[model samples]
Target: MNSSESNENVKEASSIEAIEDEDPTVLESSTSETEVDAANTSSSATEGKVRKINTETFIAEIFDYKANPTKWVYKGSKPAIIDFYATWCGPCKRVAPIMDELAEKYKGQVNFYKIDTDQEKELSGSVFGIRSIPSILYIPLDGQPMMSTGLSAKDEYINQIEVNLLKK
Candidate 1:
C-alpha cells in the first residue's frame, strides 16, 4: 500500500481505539443518574398510566401560552406538570424515564412536559424562575403552582395528579 493510504488506515484505527478507551466511571455515573431519576419518578404512579406531551404541538393541543410572556396561565381546568431539567445533570437523567412513564400512564388526564434548561434557558428560567435541576412544578387549573424539588416517590406523583389535577 502507498504511504498516504497506510496513514489514513492508521488514523481511523486510533480514533476507534480512543472511543473504546473512554472512562467507565463517566459512563456509569451518567447511567446511574438516569436510573435514579427514573426510579424516583416512577415510584408514585406504579399503578396509574401516563401520557406524553409533544413539545412542538403542546401549545396547540393544550393552551396557546407561547405568545404570552408569562408562559403560564392558570385556567383552572387541566392540571399540568412541568419538569425543568438539564441534559448533563445526573438527577435530571434519573428523573427523565420516570417522567416518560408518567406521561404515558396519565395520557389524557394530566399534562406532562420536559423543558431542557440548556436549550430553553431564557424561556424556562426567566419565566419559571427555575434555580435548580429536577424542579417539578405542578400547576392546577385554578390555583397557584406547587413546586417540588429533588426526586419524589411514585405514589406522591400519582396522588398529586389524581387529587390536584384529575379531580378538578
Candidate 2:
C-alpha cells in the first residue's frame, strides 16, 4: 500500500483506540440523572434548579429510555423541563431568562434542563423531533412530555408548569 493509505489506516486505528480507552463508569456517572438524583437526595442540597444535559444525560437522568421506537418511558423522580435551543436564535435567547426565573420560583419542585440544538443535532432532530428554536419539553411525573416551540410568555410557562408539573 502507498504511504497515504498507511497513514489513513493508522488514523483509523487511533480513533478506535481512543473510543476503547474511555471509561464507561465515568461516562455513565456524569450523564446519569439517576446517580445525580440519588446523590442529591442523600445530601441537603437545593433542588428545582436548572442544569445542562447532553444526550447521555438525557437518556440516563431524564427519560432513561431505550431504543424502542414506539413507547415513551420517563425515568425521572420529579417533573422536568428541557429547553431545546441554539445559541444564535433570538427566540431562544429571550426565553432563557424566563426559564431561569421559573427554575428559581419552582426550585425543589421541578427540574429544568437546557440542550443546545446546534451541539446535539442528533438528539434535537431524531430523538426530540425538534424543528424549531426555543422548543421546550414539559414532562410530568406520570404522563407524556409535552413540546412547545417558539417564544412564550412567562405566564404561559407558569401555567403549564403548574398545570402539568405541579398539578396545582
Candidate 3:
C-alpha cells in the first residue's frame, strides 16, 4: 500500500487499541427511540434494553462460528452491536449506559448485546480474538462483521452503525 493508505491504517488501528485508561465518562453523547428493541426484559431480538449474551446464545443468535468455521454467517433480523466487555473494566462500565441508551433509541431497528469476556473464554479469545476489554463487533445483516478494539466516542459508534450497519 501507499504511504497515505498505510498511515491511515495505522491511525485507525491506533484509535482502536485496547484502551487501558480511557475515561468514557469524559465523553458526551445523546440517545433516541425507534426501529429496534435491542435488549429488554428478555433477550428478544425484537427490542428492549442492552442484554448480556453467552457463547451458546451467540452461536444460536449471532453466528455459528463452530458450524461454519471458514465463513462468517450472521443469523439475525437486524443489525447488531455486540459489546464484548468485562465487568472489571472501568471503560466497559462507562460504556454500559451508552449501550443501554442506544438499545432503547434503536429499539426494533437494531440488536444490542453484551458479552462478558471474563466468562466466555472461548468466545472472547478463541473465537473473536478479543485482545482488549471493549472490543465491539458491529454486525450488519448482509455483510461481514467488523471489530473495533478499545474505547471511543459514542458518536463514532453511532456513525459506524449509520454508515456500516444501517447503510445511511
Candidate 4:
C-alpha cells in the first residue's frame, strides 16, 4: 500500500472509532421527549412547554406538504410546532424570541422548529401554504396540523399546545 492509501485507511478507522465511542445515553439525555414529559409531569407540571428539535431530525421526521393544496401527515410519537416566518417581517421578529424561550422551557415535551420563508421560499409558500408572516403550525402525533396566522401571544401558543398536543 502507498502513503496516501495508508493515510486514507487511518482516517476511516478514526471516524469509525469516534462513532463507536459516542455516548449512547446522549440520545436519551437530549432527544427523548417522553423522558422530559415524565419529569415535567412529576415535578413542575404547569411550566412545561416546547421542546427544541434537532434540525436534521426535524426534516427527516416530519412530513412535508404543499400549501393550500397539500395536507400535513404526522406520524411521530411526540407532537410538534413548525414556525413559518421571514427575517424581514417585523411581527416574525417579535415572535422569534418567544419561540426560542418555549424551545428551552419545553425541552423534552413538544418539538419546535422554525422555517425561514425567505430562505425556504418554496417550502414556506408552496408547500405549507403560508401566505402571511408568523404562521404557526401545530402538529399533533395523530391528527392534522392546526394552522394559526399572525403574531400570537405566548399564552395562546402554550394553551393550544397543551390542550391539543401534550394532553394527548
Candidate 5:
C-alpha cells in the first residue's frame, strides 16, 4: 500500500479505537453489551443467529486493532464475519437471510455480526471505507480481514467460511 493508503488505515484504526474508548455499547449489534454477552453465552438458545456490531464492539471484540494498528490482530477466540449493510438496500435484504443461515450453520464454530451502514456512517464510511450495501468482512483467527461487497451465492459464502474462517 502507498503512504496515503497506509495513513488512511492508521487513521481508521485510531478512529475505531477512539470509538471504543468513548462508548462500548455504541458498537454492539443489538440492545447493549450485556444483551449481546448474554446471547453469546447462550447462543444455543437461538439457532443460526447473527449479532449486530458497532464501532466500539468492532474494535474490542472482533479485533483489538487499536492495540496494534500496524498488523492483523484478531481479538476473539473464534473467527468472525461482519456484515456491513443498509436496511433499505434490496441486495442487503437478499443477503440478510443468507447471513442468518450462515451464522446458524457456523454457530459455535464462528461468530456472526451485522453492522448497519446507515446507523454507523463513520465506521462504515471512514473506518471500513464501505461504499455499498452488504459488504461482508471475513475475519480469520490469524490473518488480515477480507471484504466482499454486493450479494453473493450461499455456496460462495460457505466457501469463504470454510477456507478463510475455518481454514479447513
Candidate 6:
C-alpha cells in the first residue's frame, strides 16, 4: 500500500488500540467526535440473538462514547461482541450467519450486537474509525476489548470467545 494508505491504517490501528488503552468505545463513524447525535437509548437488547444496535443503544449498553470519549467502561453483565457491518457489504453478509450461529451458541455467556455502518455513520466511521466492514469488537467482562477486522471462520470466533472472553 501507498504511504497515505499506510498512514490511514496506522490511524485506524491507533483508534483500535485506544480500546486497549482504557477500553474506550467511541465509534466516530462519519462526523467528528463532537458531532454525534445522542438520541434516546435503551439497553433492552435480547441475548442469544444477532440484534441490530443503534447509536443510542450502543451508548446505553456498550459504552457512552459521546459522554466519555477518553475512557470506556463496559456496562454489561456478560461478555459482548459488537460486530460492525453494512447491508451492502458482501463480506459482511457472509459473516452475518456465522455471528448468528455464534450468538445462539454462546447465548447467556456472551452478548452479540451488530452495528450498521450505513445507519450509524458516526459510530462506524468516527467512534470506531472503521474503514471497512465486518470489524468486531470483542469485550471481555474485565480488562481490554479486542478488535478483529475482516472475515474469518466460525471456529475463529469460537476461539476468540473461548480464549479471549471466557479464558477457557
Winning candidate number (lDDT): 6
lDDT of 4 at 146: 62
Alpha-carbon deviation at 90 in model 2, angstroms: 0.8
Clashes of each: 24, 3, 15, 5, 4, 13
For all the candidates, what are their Cα RMSDs to the real structure? 19.7, 16.5, 8.9, 20.2, 8.9, 8.8
Candidate 5 C-alpha lDDT tens digits along 88-147: 667878998999998878878988888877676777766666655567777778766777
Candidate 5: 10-residue stretch with minimal lDDT? 19-28
Model 5 spans with C-alpha error above 4 angstroms? 1-47
lDDT of 6: 0.69
Q: After aligning candidate 4 to the native by TM-score, how far in Å is the CA of 23 from where it should be?
A: 48
* Tens-digit per-residue lDDT, 99-138, candidate 6: 9999989988998888877688877777777765678888
Clash count, candidate 5:
4
The global C-alpha lDDT for each of the candidates, from Candidate 1 onward, is 0.52, 0.63, 0.67, 0.54, 0.66, 0.69
Cα-based TM-score, every candidate:
0.56, 0.71, 0.74, 0.60, 0.71, 0.74
Write the residue-wise lDDT of candidate 1 on 1-101 in tens digits: 33333222111111011212121222111221232222234324532333332333345443445564434544434567877676687777788788778
**Predictions ranked by lDDT, top down?**
6, 3, 5, 2, 4, 1
Model 2 stretches astray by more than 4 angstroms: 1-46
Across 23-76, the per-residue lDDT of candidate 3 in tens digits comes to 232222223122232323355543757777777888888788778886777788
Error of 2 at 166 (Å): 1.3
Q: Write the per-residue lDDT of candidate 2 for residues 1-168, one digit (tens) a residue.
A: 333332221111110012121212111111212223232232124355567667777777666445544456777787888887776677788998999898889887888888877666667766665656677788888866667666777877887777667987
Candidate 1 TM-score, true structure as reference: 0.56
